[model samples]
Target: MGWIGETVDSIKSLQIRQVLTQTVSLGMIVTSALIIWKALMCITGSESPVVVVLSGSMEPGFKRGDILFLHMSTDPIRAGEIVVFNVDGREIPIVHRVIKVHERQDTGEVDVLTKGDNNYGDDRLLYAQGQLWLQRHHIMGRAVGFLPYVGWVTIIMTEKPIIKYILIGALGLLVVTSKE
Candidate 1:
């Protein structure tokens, strides 16, 4: 009986150590992800180097759940180029294609008008009140690349908090139970 009790105590101690190791490993994984995101931001010169498309307004070119890679550069924005921009009062950024570009001769500032491929009209109604065009400051980045449907995970995690928590719990459990 005494030997059995000692063995049980050792098992409990080993389980605790395994849990702690797994927790640290999970922390390291999250930290590495953050580091990679920051590196992409720096390299692309965009505040958001990657964004998940949340709307179908740009369908046929970009669809919902697509992951867009953005790049900010000094090159002039031209007509037909896709861009992401934030509205004055809107929290979500919008992705659309430039339909018109009006360059100011006096200040060299460019004013751009955008339209969604699936929409019949331009994006004037989406803009802020009394605003007609999107200035350079309003633009965040231009779409450089995209991965189709890859962002569905992000959308699912965002829309279903319980599923996200369950996934995290399951991953932690797997790590804690996994034997070397």
Candidate 2:
């Protein structure tokens, strides 16, 4: 009876220790993710250093579910360079190639016209009413690199909220109940 009581107490203590260990590990994982995201933002000088392609407009070069790495540079934008920009009333940013660049001599401000690689006409029709060109302020970043198809996970999570919640719950359970 004495030996059994001692063993039960030890098992309870071990369970508590395991739960504490797993909690710390989970905190570390979340902290590391935030640190890495902030580091990328700093290095690229863009609020969003990465973006998922949602449209096939830039097809052949970048398909839907592709991830594009973005970089903001002080250098002037020119025709033929791919860029991401936000429209005046739209919530989503657009990725397209610069078709024309008009630089002001007095202020050095640039006005840009962009067109999707797969589209027939330029993006003027897509812009806000009466807006002819994208200004420097509207530009977010230039495409620096890409990873194909990895963004599908993000799209899936967004499209199916239930699956996302299930995955999160599973991860939490695994972390808490993990042996090592």
Q: What is the C-alpha local distance difference test score of each model?
A: 0.94, 0.95
lDDT string, candidate 1, 26-69, tens digits: 78998999999999999999999999999999998888999999
**lDDT agreement of model 2 with the native:** 0.95
| 158 Cα displacement, candidate 1 (Å) | 1.4
Off by over 4 Å in 2: 1-14
Candidate with best lDDT = 2
Off by over 4 Å in 1: 1-11, 15-20
Per-candidate TM-scores read 0.88, 0.91
* Weakest lDDT window of 10 consecutive positions for candidate 2: 10-19
lDDT for model 1 comes to: 0.94
lDDT digits (tens) for residues 50-118 of candidate 2: 999999999899999999999998999999999999999999999999999999999999999999999
The Cα error of candidate 1 at residue 96, in Å, is: 0.2
Model 1 alpha-carbon miss at residue 11, Å: 6.9
